[model samples]
Target chain A: MKIKGKTWKFGSNVNTDDIIPARYLNTIDEKELAKHCMESLDINFSKNVKRGDIIVADENFGCGSSREHAPIAIKGCGVSAVVAKSFARIFLRNSINIGLPLIEIEQTDKIKNGDEIEIDFENGILTNLSNNQSFHFSKYPEFLQNIIKNGGLMKWTAKKYIK
Target chain B: MTITEKILANHCGQKEVVPGQFIEADVDLVLANDITGPIAIEEFEKIGAKKIFSPEKIVLVPDHFTPCKDIKSAELVKILRNFARKYGVRFYEIGKVGIEHALLPEEGLTLPGQLIIGADSHTCTYGAIGAFSTGVGSTDAAAAMISGKVWLKIPSTIRFIYYGKLNKYVGGKDLILWTIGKIGVDGALYKSMEFTGETIKTLPMDDRFTMCNMAIEAGAKNGIIEPDEITFSYFKNTLNNNIQNLKSDSDAKYEKTIEIDVSKIQPQVSAPHLPSNAKDVGEYKNVKIDQVVIGSCTNGRLSDLKKAAEILKGKKVNSQVRCIIIPATQKIYKQAVDEGLFDIFLESGCVIGPPTCGPCLGGHMGVLGKGETAISTTNRNFIGRMGDTKSFVYLANPEVAAASAIKGEICHPEEIK
Candidate 1:
């Protein structure tokens, strides 16, 4: 599926705490998590986000703690794609394993905030509508791509193993 | 080949290994805490193994569910305790021990140059003592338990070379926080951080441990400070000399090299929401605080307590703010009590919590309310981490944390003491 949205820009090291605080981990539900997304940075993040929006951030976008809820919260909030200079290893693995699209763009600073963006995972193209710029990342492995298309590891595992 | 490749090659008996190549190695040890043990036990049952792979290699600790705050967590820990006993696993219950990572290395359970896995992500803390450790899921942990082997992709290695000694008030925690700020969080993802420098060598074993404990926060697989005389000395009493024999080769290669000057460093704090989001502790000067915490695997060691005690001796905590101190483990707890650190803490109006990861994990204790601000020694300070979604947690070293306890504001140690 393709995704289009306006980008919300953040600086380096937007950690898990910014997404879902540790105190909020008492609940395991995703819908409850979406309300706390970026609560550490923008106090009113949950109230302001639009559907199918994108997040553009600097290096190490998800760091500190291995809570998978960070990505679940972002995805539950209808964030389509996360384009960062880099991501924490566990966060990247958790995101991809859970079917949230993450792109590592080397020149992240060039893309301005609030730019209209569209990403075609099948075509490996990331388009900036405001600047008329398009970039591409390496295609994901076939196995990983299948998992993403099926929507996260739990569903993919159930589909692949249970069936 | 990169240094990470070389180290993994050496472990797997290969000359070199590429990034994508996966290989299984002989397992050395497996650790699990109460929170993750029950889940792993369920997965371990799936393999239909009648017994554990090896009892001597298994370590089960009941740290997270200490004091058994609730019925469900108590039941879970009880199940794990029974499982540990039935399987002949080494078990450490509350009042018997504290944190598994702090006690394991000191009790001779962890050795240098061994492959260790734990269900908890902070398992990377063991890498401080030179073991190649990583965190795994319950299924993965169960797989390792079933066959005594687990798969690994050789990670890239980053070399942190130091040139100078730390100045006054700067310790290993400051150095790590500074590095995290410079590299950001994801800079070392799935990489082995090999800390090498004359300055690193001079640090006390506990200080090295404090630095290594937070390596996982940087998203690293492990943090390796090459074992030296200090490392050997720390273990000499509990383990034999032969245990420290394993060492990296002299001509090891590295993918990247980062040089840090420790002498010019000062006390630092990680602002609300991120460990890598660091700024000087003095940046938020004159801001009042509602709470102060001085405990966590990152800075709950004896030295950290001693340093905090030095500042709190004959002093009292600010009447406005509440301060809580939790020792890292029972060993540290006893030593602190024996040395009268607890008296100073109590005399200063700082409350003492059980030796568990309480406020750090936000499981219980020292929780904040809406709009309340706290300076804590724990790793993360994300919004709503300590109490309410509106509450803020600021991460700092123990000295800065203790100073803030007295001032009731975010004050650095240099400013107070």
Candidate 2:
């Protein structure tokens, strides 16, 4: 359970509305939503973001709106993971339910934009490839880890509740 | 235990629940709107669930882009309509539907001591009636639709007690803005805000709804007031005889307690970009405005309109400002018409819109352009919330919004005379 990618940085209180504006919320198509991912904050995000890239941000990322579109857009745009100082409650749950891995690290400022980083989900270790620095984040609880391991709540619930 | 804990524990079939403990609670009511309903239904189908756990328990409202702003939105609404019809789910059509939060309580769908979940964050609005209602995302809503249950981490309680009488221009909106300013946006993150005190008890049900509606602006799980006579009377004809009077226990523990003197408080305004960036209205007396919007689940009730009408009657809006008024629900819209508030608005040069969530989320009806400024009665003054990213929004009570429209700048209601 490890992920490696270049990082894109955002400031604190990055609201969901900026992640995906309300106008584009009419459709549930992940690809369509991905086209506008982070367009408000960075117009070139969807165009330049590569698969397995990472997004690192300051505190209270994904703050406004309960729209799951924010995480869906981020995940659909081929970002592997999002590491932030903290997340709004609903955003954290939505990301987990949708199988988008989110890590909370206190020293997010240490990771600069475009820095190559690797995250070890099992060991809670974050290695900055460019700088050779290491940081640690708390591991998820057992149940939450299982949900992530199962790839999302939908798959987890399907396996557990359905025959 | 606090009232929120009591409700969650009751639904979870537990003797007691503590903060930070994950619990799966039975949902008595579930809600989704047009914007989130299509996505939730798609996820619900992906789970391979044949039918909803309970058709009657689920409520769908298409208020966000109602009347179908575009072909895509129309198609989205069609998806919801077809699903609702096939599954026998309760659906409120355009004319019947308003803001989901306001419609639920007005229709008596939300009850005290009930655990309710919605796809929209403002769903916390129902906590005004003592219901343990909170917001979740589309996938969470989809899971709830299938299983009739959702997982929630028990949140600690933060109690706020208000005393003394409110000033003439001050109301629930001012109180909430003041609170949000005192506590930063994340001050109550993942915590239940239980409001109590003489001022709250005497406040009208509409004001209570206004107060609870903005709890999410402070990142609160829910904002609630114990059911009082005003709340009971609002539900008197609809509620059953066995209604519960849920309240916090005398020995209940709280993470924090805040006491506010209502009499000493002034009409507050949350400035641009953050609801927590609040200031006394006197501080921004001459901040010019380009638009004035008075509606949304927050501050769009009949009382809000009446206040605005009182300020706008026999007066016209300034030539430089665009004033838009939207009633929260159809019932409120009809009542405003019956009370001649619509005439006052039209004569005052305000554009009266149907019951919809127009322009509040920058969706439609009165979106601001670049470099514009608006004084809005709705909550959440986040950057680009009303329109362009460069546009500015100042949040205030309905009275201040109306007065600003007339003056084309931020002004207190008392200054209108």
i-RMSD values for every candidate model: 4.8, 1.2
lDDT of 2: 0.90
How much lDDT does each candidate structure score?
0.77, 0.90
Q: Write the per-residue lDDT of candidate 1 for residues A88-154, one digit (tens) a residue.
A: 7667766775567899887677678889998887788888888888888767666556656776544
Off by over 4 Å in 2: B237-245
- Output the number of the TM-score-best candidate: 2
Tens-digit lDDT string for candidate 2 (B213-315): 8898888899999887787798875566544548888999899999999898888888988998888888895799999999999999999999999999999
Candidate 1 local Cα displacement, residue A73, angstroms: 6.5
In Å, residue B220's CA in model 2 sits off its true spot by 1.3
Which candidate comes out best when scored by DockQ? Answer: 2
In the range A46-101, model 2's lDDT, one tens digit per residue, is: 99999999999998888878999999999999999999998888899999999888
TM-score for each predicted model, relative to the true structure? 0.82, 0.98
State chain A's TM-score for model 1: 0.91
